[model samples]
Target: MSDTLKHLLHPKFLHMTLFGFSAGIPYFLIFSSLSLWLDQVGVEKSAITYFSWAALGYSFKYLWSPLVDRLPIPYLTRKMGQRRAWLLCIQLLIMVAISLMAMTDPASSVSALTQMALAVTLLGFSAATQDILIDAWRIEASTDKDIAMLSSVYTVGYRLGMLTSGAGALYIAAYLGTSMDQYNYFAWKISYLSMAATMLIGIGTTLWIKEPKKAAALVHQTSDYLAVVGVFIICVTVLILSYQLTADFFQSFRNQLFAWSQNRPLSATLTTASQLLLALCLATITARLVATTRWVNTDMIKDVYWSPVKDLFLRHRQHIWLLVGIICLYRISDIVMGVTANLFYQFKGFDLDEIASIVKTFGLFMTIGGGILGGFLVVRYGIMRIMIIAAVLSAATNLLFMMMVNMEKSLVFLTFMISADNLSQGMALTAFVGFLSLLVNRQFTAVQYAMFSSVMTLFPKILGGYSGGMVEQMGYANFYLMTAVIGIPVVLMLLYARKNQVFEFDQQSDQKTSPH
Candidate 1:
């Protein structure tokens, strides 16, 4: 085995793998599983879709990332490093949130159930925080050359968690219930408790691992606390002011803009531009206010909380852009198709049993296989090449589902499509994660990677929200085909990126140009 592969197979890699599993398992429990629970209780699809907005907490994790990066729990910070301390705490929160979700039923009165929804939202936010810490640890603990191997291991663990929470939880629920029509409260509670137990494994692993020693200068001091509070106040003030300003501005201008554009059709571009401007204004005001608060002056908070984001961006512009593009395109096809898969299965007249057996069970294994294959390929061939191949294969896999759209829904064909789609998704996801790790600076790994992964999720979720309408309009066959075609622009972008040697050249250039 190559040195990288050998290192990946080491015990530390296994530790990271378990950590990834702990992080991944609770996600679907709060997301898809919870959606099902709500649906079973007769929650409207519109309400369920709104619940998905709870997931926006994940996308905005960067907001609190600096805390994970800087603030250390008193004894925990001393016992464990920033990353581990943050990971363990957030994992604990996730456990609590999941258990609470299991205890409550959304079918109860809206006033009573609002707390339950909040609990699930908390779970998502906590999980997102844990993800930030994990991403930081993964990058900090590994070397550039070993990142691919580490990434693959992490992906394997992550996918396993997704599979268990999705299919495994469903099976458990199905088996425990007396009838399919009755609610499986006990089963769901056990499954959620099981998820909590699995997270403890991560806590144990964290305890066993040695904390990364902080440099003396980097250690937190009293001033850090004051700075943190100051920054917090400034950030809050700016957000409130910006919201008021924008709301007032929009309300004032709405009629005028509508009148001017009466004859002019509103394109997606115009809509996006309007939203973008509002968001940019809010973000800018918030950041500027935070900077003015002077929270960065103290030693404890200086490096931890108020370090210069602008400097990093300027220093790593090319890599940052590449990271953005990779994140945006990594699972474009998979995410787009995911929004329509169940409907497609139903449209084909496949019953729940067939769908569960083929797509959920068999399909999950194929995904694991693809992740492992992609990881191995990265170790063997390098990340860039693996990324190229995985992207192309992912695009191609969409066609398999399209072909099945009009077919007789044979078991063999279902198996074939599931295998192709899942395997390719696994490969692409692994490569994409490895690439993300490479882009992060170890000093700000959690915050930077959180930003990247958040962006990775944001666009997909926004686009996916409309997927049901699209499928309803175009029908399943054409929808799948269109999903496949969506991959084309991303593939072309990847090709252009590779040909330009974006990351490679940027790294070399940074080294040569740095003021040592």
Candidate 2:
């Protein structure tokens, strides 16, 4: 076996893989599995599609990651290490949240949807928080040369987790719910309970693994409290104001929209798109305003909040926005497609058993192979080079689903199409994760990573929420093609970044220490 192959199988990969599994399991339980559940339970498809917004928690996790890095749970911090303790606490919350979801029935009452959304949000928030710690831990654990190996196994493990959680849960629910009573709420509850129990994978890993020793201590002075409070109040204020503005605009736009389209599909899409754009604009403006505002607490707040931005700006210089733009657009095509994929499978006449067996199980192995190959390619040829290829292939694969449209649901055809799609996705995701990992500064790893992950997710999730409307308007064939076309810009931007020296793919982990 080659050194790359050897590195991939190193025993150390086990821990990262387990944590990756833990991360993947909850993610799909909240996302794809829940989508399947809600759709079967008679929730409106659009409403179920909108539930993807609950996952925006992952995008915003950076907002609190600084706290996770800076503070520790009172007693838990002493009993367990900082990252480990946070892992345990968050895992406990996830278990409880999943259990709560299991007990609630979306068909039970009017608030069933709301309850499900809240539960999903809670699960997502907890899971995203866990991710913050795990990413930091993984980076800290590996040497620069081995990061790719770790990244690949993490991808592999996460995909396997998805296979089990997504397919396994579907099968378990199907088999257990043979009786037809209000859409088999009882079986779903047990499946959720099973998901809750899977938290043990993370909990056990946290206990067994050693905390990274180089982790920094939070610097604090009594005067810093003022800055912290100022940041808290200002950030909260900005969010409140932005939300109010978005709500008013949404309502006003709705009233005026009928002049253009009576069905309101176009109006709804524009409104959703506008709200996302407005939120992004407000956030950027808030960052700028906070950075420039001169107050007694300026230095303190900047250190606490804007340090990551300053570090990145110094590295990227004037090209920061271009870099941000690329990251924002990179993963969106697949993500948006993912939001409505299960529904599409159903609409195309595949039953739950077929979806579970084929899409989830067969595609899982293809993804693992693609992800591992992606990791090896990154180690050998460098990231930017492989990312260019992966990006192109990733975009192209979405076109496969277009062929499934209005055709008979042949398992053979679905298998070949999805296998190709999953393979490309695995490669793209592995490269993407490694790419982000490289950019993180050890000093602000949690926050900067959260920021990057958030930027990557926010637009996609928001736009994906409107997918039901998009498909209703354009139909799946056009919508899938549109997703493929959207990915073209990523390839162009990457080539430009490489030419301009904004993209760095040749780093062996030696993480930069922040200048004190």
Candidate 3:
């Protein structure tokens, strides 16, 4: 290994890889193992897919990331500092949740298993929380000079963690006699418990690493944001619940006032309108009450939560819509096309072993290499230029898969198409991430970046969820062609944005250019 790589192995820095491993484990456990286990127990494939929604915690983590950034655990905050405290607190929660998920019987009722699967959601939630803090620690612990190395090591570690959980879990389960028609509950129980045991990796790393120097500063700023948000949400929920009362009361009044006409359709309309008016009145009154009420340490409710997001929109009001539009479109082709990759492989007649060998094992390394190359390409050609190229390539790669399905399901052909697709995705990921990095204001780094990222995925995921239906209707080739056609708009938008200079230097660059 190179000395820099070797340095990553040092005791002090080893935690990055450990953290990555920790992050990667839950991913496959929630998706792959859970799916496999459910299938083994004769759960409907559709139901299994629905449970995948449990992983949506990762997607919506940003909604609560602001609180993660600003809130501190009561006791741990005092002892371990902000980042470490949150990391450790959530780590234990995740561990406990995973352990509960492990103990859940596959023989349980669907509702019972679903409730147990919610434990996986909690696990995902805790893992996302840990990720936010880990990211904070990575930046604050390393100098700007070493950020690259830390990122590389952390990514390498994360991928390794994924591989271990995914392939490693399968191998372990097989050994436990849960493989190939065994649906062995005890065996799976043992295997899941085994997975839970591995969380000590994160626990050890959390305790081993020193809290970043800036932890105290972060905690101070995050002061009481959690309490304030909690109270606000509760007040809002209560006010919403108040609508039920108003609606009921208004319905009763309307019925009494128009008893003779109560059987008429017009009377029904009148009741609805009257109830809506009453609800509005009650809501307005409640709003005034909340505004006037001095609830628990109102001083801690600083503008930090919404300020960064508000500032971005206000400053870019001229072209913010256009910029956000480009972000949504850029990855639509890649994500939508990916939705059918496995189905395409199956359609092409590849067996599970062959698919796993080439697509899972070999494709992973190709993706990593592509990501590394993409990073270098971003350095050589600026992110905008490389991103445009990646967008184009991403759009074009769908054609390869479209062509592959017409063939005799050759492994060589499948490998080639998958490799090309993975490369394009890896390159686009790096460049797109760089592009997002350019958009964020450091003042609201967590919130701004999360907002950008969450929005970026939302459109793609929503659109991609329908891809199976698209394939069903149009067949693989036509579906892919449609996906490719969608990419043209993204290309046009990027080109226009470049022409008009819609986005150039973001907050970081502006800070550098500012007068001292």
The top-ranked prediction according to TM-score is 2
1 against 3, candidate with superior lDDT: 1
List all candidate RMSDs to the true structure.
6.1, 5.0, 8.7
- Model 2 TM-score? 0.88
What C-alpha lDDT do the candidate models reach, one value each? Answer: 0.69, 0.81, 0.66
Best by lDDT: 2
lDDT tens per residue, model 3, 4-45? 667556664577768877887787677666766676677644
How many backbone collisions does model 2 have?
1
Q: Please give the TM-score that candidate 1 achieves against the real structure.
A: 0.80
Residue 134 in candidate 2, Cα distance off native in Å? 0.7
Which scores higher on lDDT, 1 or 2? 2
Could you estimate the TM-score for every candidate? 0.80, 0.88, 0.74
Error of 2 at 40 (Å): 1.4
Q: Tell me the lDDT of candidate 3.
A: 0.66
Error of 1 at 144 (Å): 2.8
